[model samples]
Target: MSRTPYTSATSQSAKMRKDESFLGRLGGTLGRKKKSKEVSELHEEGKKAINAPMLPPGTDIHPEDTLLEENAERIMLDPTSRENPKFKDMLKVLIDWINSELEEDRIIVKDLEEDCYDGQVLQKLFEKLSGRKLNVAEVTQSEIGQKQKLQTVLEAVNELLRPHGWSIEWSVDSIHSKNLVAIVYLLVALAMHFQAPTRLPEHVSVQVVLVKKREGILQTALVTKELTSTTEMMMGRLERDAFDTLLDHAPDKLNVVKTSLITFVNKHLNKLNLEVTELESQFADGVYLILLMGLLEDYFVPLYSFFLTPESFEQKVHNVAFAFELMQDAGLKKPKARPEGSL
Candidate 1:
């Protein structure tokens, strides 16, 4: 019968606090789980988008063709690719080659995209390359006339190059639209097919933005892509030829050149408490090479410009490419070695 008087208000207040604490903990756990799941899903989506085949649906392509098509699309879409130093170099070389070849006709190409969009330059270049004049018009000021001429030139060029296993990556519409990527591809292919004396840059890679529509929503992804195999094959041939000549004519000079280069690199890198014993292997990852260039040129390379700790092959290549860009900016000639070659 001795039940102490209970304070009803205090009991209710305590109970409410307990319930609130439990609900808070439960909410936090649920929130964390949901966040984790969302992160995992985003990561997977990114991987899929990056690795997804860029070909059209229902299209079956050979393994070799897949790379070519993907590279072509990436270049076509990448807005920054035109500013790439390698692309600029290739464009200049192609223009010079075209001018030299068409000098007899007094045709000089100042701008590849602008001058060629009218189809006049392309027609003359095609005739010069193929050694046969096309039946297309000589001059056209109208849009329809330009497109018509472009179609004729592209068709004939494709017919002539396709049989030799050269696939044209450009179209009449793309060319008439003055698509720089397509124009560069077309010019590079013609240069290779005709055995022009121009030396194109090799292993050129570009960052591309790909846009896709999913569930009526548009999403974009950025990826890096190497251009077609045509340029790579051409550069490979040149490298092999140069290497053979060095081996045959200056076998002893190879060691001398290596020693000199190593000395130079070490002299510059010594300031950073680094020494390069093997240039080939040490510079393969591009870390030391970037540092060496920065040191030798007396310029500070912003840490943000390159990966300080590159964990992937692609990152290493990116570092080397950045170094090459730095060289170009410094008014130095870029070495013949491809960015991937450093690896």
Candidate 2:
């Protein structure tokens, strides 16, 4: 049998084919790399075009006048202002005051923006404070209806404030649009004007962002301003009558206050598998108070020192007095509250 002999011609042809295949693959890889680089460059160029300055060169931009335009929208409170401790405290006080005033009507205001945008709460608050109800709807579900109600309510509120020589700081459109700064301003003004028996924080300030359109271009400015200074001054001008306690002037407020205290107490007590419902009756026994003190002060109260289940008024009073004494021993200022008062 004759076998095919390996030849130089055939070997040379195979080597050439291999070299051509490698060259084709290498060329394809380089082409792909070049195409990727071009795409990346185009992407960078597009980003640069988007981020470029809007105004043409040599077009003068007056910072103050642009921000002060009548059509300018105060967009939002600055993050620094919204997160400020004083601002949070002021918002709490304002919300508590509103809840205290409207508690009897079963109107609970949890958020100033979400709740007041519909104008129902504001109208009720106005009627409750001014003792004059406007001819607005009690509740409106539609945007148009809410706007109409807001217009009527704000107009009446402005009228009420005008007689006191104070101009309206918020507009109907602002409130209906849920502008928090505008809502806060309106609520603060109402709180001060009505002298809602709650004490408002003085000299609170916040930073706001104002946005305006000039020549079809949007411009923004950061403005820092006092929210409560004017209200504080107005409050100061009023007569210095002795402020009535919440229990005396507004008994409904006492219930709301009691509920809040109970919630706070329960939050701490829940760790010990305890809950508080009625503060007056529950704390009257002084058992919860003693436990609360021990938990808060991080000290173990001797079991023998106080009654766990006080069956009589005298025993309850003893437990409360012992708790107060423990507080005093811990260098805590003795509360002006009396132990017998709880009993």
| Candidate closest to the true structure, highest lDDT | 2
**Candidate 1 local lDDT, residue 54:** 58
Alpha-carbon shift of residue 181 in model 2 (angstroms): 1.0
Off by over 4 Å in 1: 1-77, 211-219, 223-225, 228-232, 235-343
TM-score for each candidate, following the candidate numbering? 0.45, 0.51
Model 1, 106: alpha-carbon shift in Å?
A: 1.3
**lDDT of each residue in 124-166, candidate 1, tens digit only:** 9888777798887778889999999988888888988787766
Per-residue alpha-carbon lDDT of candidate 2 for residues 93-128, written as tens digits (9 for 90 to 100): 788878977999998888888999989999999998
lDDT of each: 0.73, 0.75
lDDT of 2: 0.75
Candidate 2, number of clashes: 0
Error of 1 at 202 (Å): 1.3
User: What is candidate 1's TM-score against the reference?
Assistant: 0.45
